[model samples]
Target: MTKRSSRLDDAARAGWLYYVAGNTQDQIAVKLGVSRQSAQRLVSLARSEGLVRVQIDHPIANCLELADALRDRFKLKFVDVVPTDPGSESTITGVAESASAEMERWLRREQPVLIAVGTGRTLKAAVELLPRMDCRQHRVVSLTGNIAPDGSAAYYNVVFTMSDSVNVRSFPMPLPVIATTSSEREMLHAQAMIRPTLALADKAEVTFVGIGDFSNDAPLYVDGFITAAELKALQKAGAVGEIVGWSFDSEGKMIRDITNDRVASAPIPPRETSLVIAAAKGPRKLPGIRGAIHGGLINALITDEDTAAKLLG
Candidate 1:
């Protein structure tokens, strides 16, 4: 092997041990079977050679200030604002990963608590980032039905994926999120097969949901779950956002729309002491997030710094 290539490999190993493994110089030296001075030199060399790239996972002072401001403004229970780069819009948008960390924190608790989850791209992305753990002590339930009107499963049903990650017992509502009619939804909700799931969903103290912005790019319309006319009707009814397929207006009140009437998903409004955390970000979601906060639909929030600033603005 070339001497240069060998050195590069050593530097990479040193970087991984010191950064990823959270090892001190003494520990790294012992593990690498080298003197502490040599280990320190290796770590410095790794940084100089660009083998070490440390990314801070904790929120910076600016982000913490933003979080505190949002919480105070809305009288919320918890808030996390992921740091963003002014020049790099893409780099600062890891809200899903940050939310996943919060989810992990709650799941790691020894007490077995009921966790409810909503469906969307945001939630699916967060579930995908979860590290597998033995969390069978807890229970997880879906806040929305798993199917579309066409009988196909919803594209972003997240409880199953979350169950796989944490080894938790999961209950998924097998019906469509929005039935064809109010009567159909009533019939679906009344079914004995779905009763247990709905009942359990009602008891969840910790809930994670995705905020859907009412815009030209609304996920319900884009995913073919709701027709263009239905979307227009929802917008006309003053729906600024949706959670668990229930459309709400700027004041956070459920609008008088057929969409809300036909929704078969478990209707879980903010309960006393319930922790409902919504993960959303970007310019389009500012109004929707504001609406959710105004209505007390979500007591906790996870978002990026850019969106938080826009919401406050």
Candidate 2:
């Protein structure tokens, strides 16, 4: 390497050590076998010469076109595309990777309220990718809840995981999503504990939700929210998939079934930035996903190539 280029490299290295590595000038000097003053000078040189540039590493080219297409088609604020290999583990892994990056961005942004929803494995994977956040001014609230006794309430994990990521306020629903009768639901809604979170959902600035399929193996179904009998009923009713707990058909029209009515009944009035970040793959989700898109429930989406192609198709 040239003499000037070598100096630039040394300066850049020392600058990175001081900033990203959390090293003091003296510490950097010790590590680099230089005096503290020299370390300081190098840092200054790196900055002055523009050798230190902060780059957000994202799969722009591969993901951007698809992202733009979704955004334009669905009026989404943003979309993330994961171009995975055609088969095998590509779908889940790619979606997970993109979600991790997206979650990091969401946590970093200064937002007032984040309303979350429950639906599928892809959402679960995205929730798993969230790191513990430490922001104090933000609030995270669940958009819906589980109803059946066997339902695992995976949305609780979404709340817990997101709360850990940012040291912000968290609101969790402590009731079944649906009651056996309207009277029972009315009583639960009257409870003070549930009312506050319901109020929070009304004021949500952004919402993160996953889409759901009507199949028996759907994540929500497997999580015990939907029983085998219920699956059959939904299938017979021509129910396709769900968005924020609201089930619909192939064209995204609301099914108005009992189970779906439970979710649509949330107290919250949807926010203007009511973003539904749906992440899923496969032909099975096409109807449900397209329905969500057609219904205008999702203002944002993040998914893999296969899923995106299917949706576009």
Candidate 3:
């Protein structure tokens, strides 16, 4: 073999001996006929060259305790509780960063994958934090409409950002957030181009979404996607929060009102999706997050420690 290849082979061996076999540098040196210092350098070289990887499996006590409580309370498949200064903006940032790391790991899977995404500020932040990679084997589909009434894809559009970050194809739902009428929504759903994307969303292995509280400060109203009167009506109808434009009550049952029919994007039934991961944080989001969990809208969650405590309570 060439000198470079031979050196790499030796480094790999040294790394295995020191890390895996629990051998000292001196022992590695004796086995490989190298000096102790040379063995140390070889292990370092192995790590720097990506021939070896180290992982700490030790769990943080507080975080693990909170995670366990949340999982048990909500019957959640997975929960990640990130430490944050309570009530600070870092609450959102911490959750978003953790969710971003999880997304990167999921995208690294060797099998072809489809990731459905929902729109919201937290979800957008997670997408922005995601590491850039060229994952052409994956497809991203939007679980919400791309446009608002004012012809803007401004805040509640994350599919494009995800596609750009990962360099993959994205299928945005080409419809308005709230169609003017039920018939219009039906017509939009019937379109040939829209059908396939919706079908793809139904079969997605994993979906990332955000939970939105149904107060006056609701994103739909604040972003001008819904009128003040509409927000009031939703609240009157016993809505507590929204998931993918569909509002639900505190008990997690869909509030089937006019708004439900007017929503263009069809809600992906939680049972249909293998994994529904919701990333959210903050006191304002706690009610919505709880509603989602109670309703079985999401199986996994990523949120800050404070929010996790609140949810557990």
The models' CA-based lDDT, in order, is 0.84, 0.67, 0.83
- Candidate 1 to truth, TM: 0.81
- Could you give candidate 2's per-residue lDDT for residues 1-313 as a string of tens digits? 6998988888989999987888899998998888999999999997776455443565567567777787787777778887756657533666655665666666677755564545345655666666556766666777666444555555534665555445767776776755566677778778888888787777776666666777767655676666778778777787788765567777667776557654423642353646556676666777787877777666677777777866776
Question: Whose lDDT is higher: candidate 2's or candidate 3's?
Answer: 3
Which digits, one per residue and each the tens of the lDDT, describe model 3 over residues 1-313? Answer: 6999999999999999999999999999999999999999999998776566443356678888999999987889889888767546543667776787788888887777888899888788778776668888888889888987888775668988787667877899988888889998989999999999988888888988888888788988898878899899999988888888888888888888648878887576455456999898888778888888888888999987788888877
Model 1 CA deviation exceeding 4 Å by range: 1-57, 87-92
lDDT leaderboard ranking = 1, 3, 2
Clashing pairs in 3: none
lDDT of 2: 0.67
What digit string (tens of lDDT, one per residue) describes model 1 on residues 51-73? 55444666599899999999999
Candidate 3 positional error at 176, Å: 0.9
Best by TM-score: 1
Among all windows of 10 consecutive residues in model 2, the one with the lowest summed lDDT is 262-271
Model 3 RMSD vs true structure: 8.8
